[model samples]
Target: RAVLAAAGGVAAGGLTIGTAALLGGTGKGREPGGSPPEGEAAAAASEEAGTRAIADPVRRAGHLLRRAGFGGTPGDIAEFASLTPVEAADRLVDFEDMDNSGLEERIARANFNLTRLRGGDGRPGMASDMRAWWLTRMAYTARPLEERMTLIWHGLLTSELGKLGIPRTKFMLIQNELFRRMALPRYDDLLKAISRDPAMMVYLDTIQSSAAHPNENYARELMELFSMGVGNYTEQDVREAARAFTGWRLTAPPRVQLPEGASEAERRAAQDAAAEAYEPEFIIQPRLQDRGMKTFLGKTGPFGGDDIIDIIMSHDAPSRFIPVRLFREFVHANPGPETVAWLAEVWNGSGHDIREVVRAILKSAEFNSEAAYRAKIKSPVEFVVGAVRGLELETDFRATLRFWGPMGQTLFQPPNVAGWPGGPAWLASATLFARLNFLDAFLFPRGRPLRVEALLAREDAAGMVDEALRRLVDGVMSEGARAALVAHAESIRDPVERAATVAYLVLASPEYQLA
Candidate 1:
């Protein structure tokens, strides 16, 4: 259902990204931005723990969708509600195919997306523009679970060309290829793809890695960021692994203007010739490599790049780390511990099968339990993007890219290698202001199928706060929180004020921001 907009885009009065908010969501004025006291948090935890005592699939599906993929559309929730763990697993791939139907086309379109010189991020848009695309896709996707998995894997198996001063076109090509081909494949296959990627080579300094001047950057990340995680591998291991990845490089994207009726053989030959013939192409300089024995995660033997990947993947750490991450991502952080121990068993048993681990998590009592739903805070990326999708504000996603910039994320530009500290970091006063204001950007005052106020009216207002709470939260809100929202709405006389007040309360509420 690719509906091309006629000439001028969706009208201004209807659902749209509010572009003129001179007062953007910004600042770090949060009232002590950190996790709440244990006692209060634990009580809330217990209440959520209480919700899990029943068999509520819609609730469970919603719980899973919020963290697993993006936000759940009504249809997505219903679809999730109709699945068994195996059925859910089958559904995931089906959804992936559908989501990526126009993916290549969309990527092509994004290349031509008009932009108005957004600051100096090298990327366009105000915030992380891609996140906006991701949010809507998730909101619209039939397979929310797969989206979540892709995101988790992306963080672990990272890539970026801009960070390496590589050409942008090639970088985009690599990104599209990664998601299109390996996103849903086995984690092992995904690792192999990452190892060969031009973007990964540059971003991790692997291209500079050599037989003489060994760059340990990519090697360290494979152990620290990708697989075993921190403290499991040593600096010596990084050095050894760097040597293993010697000779990894890339040919830049082509600048060919093919002649008409080029033969298939001629065209392919041209491509191969282009790759092999390009001058000043990106290439691995292996003179710096240190060929030596490096004991990584207690595996000591002569190792090369493939040997390094084998050692890392065959170890206990990646399998364990994966489930713990999946648990952290799809469920709550403090997942009964026992739940993880069991899931880890399955993950290891299945050769670190991501879908297997995810299926296990989805079926576990812990996942369906109350404690898991509203356990974590939404990353700034999730909050702002979710706001745009929730309001169905479709436009050139540049607005979202712009909005995300101030909130502290730029597409392909993370704050550092460690990535954004998601939870309390997003709750900072300055960052929180930017997040809440993101919703205000979508609220239009006039036209058909209106904006914020119209959204409030269509929803049952008696259940307005409840609906907002459900859309924003993973679990039930406290009585006090509910009362507060209703009270705020009642205090307002104007419909616009009422709607905006309700929205503010919902977004400001503890439930909305937490994952």
Candidate 2:
């Protein structure tokens, strides 16, 4: 009860800080001497408000780590803190230079059961494994930005296991690999590739589309959700794009030959095996394709899916739309028009290269500003993986797999075509409780010794509290919160228990809830 009371106090204090930060901004229209601001001075002040740099290196580095990827460890933050913002951004954004063989080896050693097991139910078990696989990568990947970009693409260009079914779950993994491989590709190229993705084809009913009956699901989502925001394109544009996207199909696996005396069970086994071994290839049937000239976004052509994607990429909306989304993901939710306009210019200049846009966002003063720090709430995945990465916890992520559903985020499953409604939605009361419960299960799993080696190096109560705060919350807690944590730590006699308790309190604090 005392622990819960102390934790609640820390949460209240942290909420106060977060709320202040969210509402706080530069005192625009006023001169520093308290005189009424002149026009140039006011403009300069607003500009400075948007582009001001974070002066503290530790906070800046911590902010970048939390936003760019999962939260970093103390060592990771310290290493990044030594570099300038531009240098730090470059290192993370240009992650192809990093050797991730160690992560690959770890994954190999973990040997995740990603495939269907013989004589066992497939989807349920494989789905759990898939979630664990991704959580492991997020926790341990050397190229954090690469995995982060993959996650962004997954949420944006979404396909779900609920629709794909047991036989086709492999397609989800294939799509995931595609996102990782082309994590920073040009926007047009990615659109083109995903347009032919098997999981997307099935999920959006693109495979069922044809010239005579062009399903508008993919076309509508592509413009309204993926590329451009709504009101930028018309229903007529959607119909036209759907017509162009017709005839999309995946190659079927060859029928398995059964023995002359084979039983029903044997036939079923052979079919399952063949389905498991099958690799889908995207193909377009010319007969089903609408070859007639159609108008799309004011351009008249015999447009196919690729042509439609190219035209969307060439449009003005995606220039603003894509960058705005990336900014929201990395910086904060509410971005000003001036900031959006500048990001759009960068997008246009770079020909919609994702790497360049991400690089600009990371290095931008706006991203490292006071407003950007702790301004956005962490998603469930971020909350879990951030804790694992921040605390340097070692696990295969199996035990915590069930917690994701309670937290309102399950891997390979998004609620709808628009993906997760992030930001404030992540902190709903139910999910908040789930998050706290998750800490309980994570910190003190059943029948396992508490793992606090990372925190145990600092033996004293104050030292332990500071260490938890430093790693979990970037060492930025109110004095009262710190004292409350220290008091809780001191009350516990066992060092391991003390370390675990402080860590739990810090993780439960509202400040750590925000990214």
Candidate 3:
């Protein structure tokens, strides 16, 4: 429905992306005071000689947007292009002040039924609806970094709606909201909160723990995945940590009162309404808790869950592991030791402040280096969201939300606790087929004309391709790819069809698959 409306809007001349917007006009790469900002200057000084900062405003802006958020549109790129690299990075990092009411309003208008749960007879789609809601936010939100960081946290401090049980699927949404609220929080605080998070407790089996038979799932993942990588802690540490976390449980939500004359269907409806309003809070049962002194990580005491988290945060491994994870996510797949060391220093000095660590990463010499530019493959979510955002198209994408499963990255349904393999693992032949087909549906939905006549208004076939390239991918195409796209566009006579085909070809090309 939204796609049809957008097409109508395009026919009515509502769609526009002028040449000035494409080139960024006065917006291309401004250095405040005609020099690198203070942090960027220091980062520049740290680089090897001849390792220049990204000079092209467009490339630098694209890199920043791709890493810090999903991909950016031409207008988004133009806005960032005008600022110094440090200024741009800071703008995204310090995002709390940004007005997000527009995105909020869109979400309100969607009118998603958050309380809908799968029935006992094997009904489904509520989880998919939740996934669609988030995808919509990613595609259209004014503050992409916040959503980006929320995604990073979701991948790391992971949970699964499937294991959360059919009745409690909406808890995943609650956990998602928590990630957004504390997206850039201090590392220790985030860990502590996750230890007490209801969804996480359920997913990791923290709620099933007892003093006599402590559940080690949460403790093992806490060290191996969340804080430090494996081998940093001994088996004893896992056992002791599990003991400390015993008695962490989920509280029962209040049930709805059924009227005497209520029918069975009405009773079920009332129960679901109550369930929607009820979010289980994390609680501790003192009777089941381990109060005995236990030695964990060489520290002997009556340590509780908070104490274990504190010990993990105080260790040096989190400083290294977390920065390495951040580096992998943003900079490159394999970061040099020096880069990791620099980021670890920032992590330690900033007292695990996520905003400061992310700021240093965005301003780092390595992040701006050529090796990091388009170096990683886009995850399934990134690929879909980037196209929508870059094309500036409108659509009620909830209908297509199921594409994530076959494309290989289903939200709230990661294959395992380790999360998606990402990188090259996302480009398997079947997945590539899925990507191409999905682009076809997106560019020309059900034979409806593309809302891209504005893209066709450029000079000719080559010009239209160039304009589409600039709008979709910051004109970073190779000569061969550009020639191929132009040739493809020239073959199609109808300008609207030519423009849509060119846009589709460019997006389907392998060049656009890398971030």
Candidate 4:
């Protein structure tokens, strides 16, 4: 419950619990917090003014939760709806003081150890196991934004469990934790850390890099994808930058090769010993490093990996590039020049502070506009995580992995270094059906009773449909969607079955797929 003082233009204690009153659909109203909500006439008078600026608390809260984190629960929405935009942004972005012992305890209780591999192409179901572990955190963590930012980094910085291999899976977890700890870190610091990060080193071939033959893989991606975007840096710059990062390698985890003719028990013992002895860490071999002056991005004088990152930060390209990508991730797929310019200003002014840039985007009028609401399709991860949180369901993360792959997203296994194509790419014919089938299974597993008794306060069909829509879709279902849901609910005479059916349909609806 530790809170920072409100930052930026929003005033303190300026919002009230008007969401309940608004969602009740009674036109009769007085503005909350003793300030009148901006009327449409006033809104019409200015480009920035709108009903969403200080009114439409529910939609505003939904937008925040959907983008800032995964979609939230009704309780999450209601609580967030009570805060002004800046206050809500503050609660999410400034989470350094928050106690996350509950999430830690849950993870401990699960006892998911990554080191235990089941053999063959690394570990069987290890990627799924990892996905489940993180999904649990996303569903139950106190700091949703932290988990959301971790996912964002995972997608953007891009690593694959398949590429990292099972023996090195622990390094992927290490990278994940790094993103969480520095979720709102300065851009320069994060780049510097990731450049030397053990998992990243292995994933991008930095481990194989040497002065004799500098591997340009990491260097190319560092400039083209990670920092300056494609085409901003030349092939020569990539070559020089690769030299700067030469000799970056990780400690070799011991591989136990059982002696021929050894008994099964003896082989097991050796494998166990190697597993226990393994310790992965980053190491720079001076002998393998290039010491001679190397020109990179027009700078010369024995630049190292850290120096290359520092030089990238010194340029405006990183400042412009990162904020724009972040804007698309959080706001909409397409960003106009004006939007980019505004966010870039925040980036520069805040010294490339991620939190400041994110806060600015969340608080901007663009984020709350109709153009951004449900504008992007839900990536499979978001859809699944949102469903679990929306229903307040307890789950075995392992079970979820089966559905995730067919539904077009498998955690820790992005298709390439560029990561998940996201947005409209998630809605292919086969994948869309997979999404529907997964929801059907999730809502009514094995045709058994639904697990949402705690979520339903009413038993009748109409009441149940309303509750489902309210809880799952931020109560923003269209009239046709509502009518369709109610019809489906009424078809089932049994109240629980009816409620579950309604929930399933809403989840399967096109509206739910958007966020």
Q: Best-fitting candidate, measured by TM-score?
A: 2
Shift of residue 123 alpha carbon in model 2, Å:
12
Task: For residues 1-515, write the lDDT of model 1, one tens digit per residue.
Answer: 00001111113443221121111100111111222324666566455554543256666666566666666655566777788644654566345455455444554555532222121346543223444455545444445555555556555566643475422323534454466455556677777777777667767777776676678788888788777888787787777778788766665556666799999977765664454334334444445445567676677876767778888888778866767876777766665566667977997788777667777776666666545545566776567556544544444455555567667655555666666666556656677667556655544323212246424654444466665655555335545446656665565556655665565556655445655
Flag the better candidate by lDDT, 3 or 4: 3
Q: What would the TM-scores of all predictions be?
A: 0.73, 0.91, 0.86, 0.87
Q: 399 in model 4: Cα distance from truth in Å?
A: 1.4
The candidate that achieves the highest lDDT relative to the unseen native structure = 2
The TM-score that candidate 2 achieves is 0.91
- For TM-score, candidate 2 versus 4, the one ahead is 2
What's model 4's overall lDDT?
A: 0.75
Q: Give the least accurate 10-residue stretch of model 2, judged by summed lDDT.
A: 24-33
Instruction: Give lDDT tens digits, candidate 3, residues 367-486.
Output: 876556666778988888887778777765776765778889889888889988887678776786687767777777897658675486785999998887887666865454566667
| lDDT, model 2, position 134 | 86
- The all-Cα superposition gives candidate 1 an RMSD in Å to the true structure of 10.3
The regions of model 4 sitting more than 4 angstroms off are 1-54, 119-125, 255-260, 263-269, 272-276
| Model 3 score (lDDT) | 0.78
Instruction: Report the C-alpha displacement of residue 414, candidate 1, in angstroms.
Output: 1.5
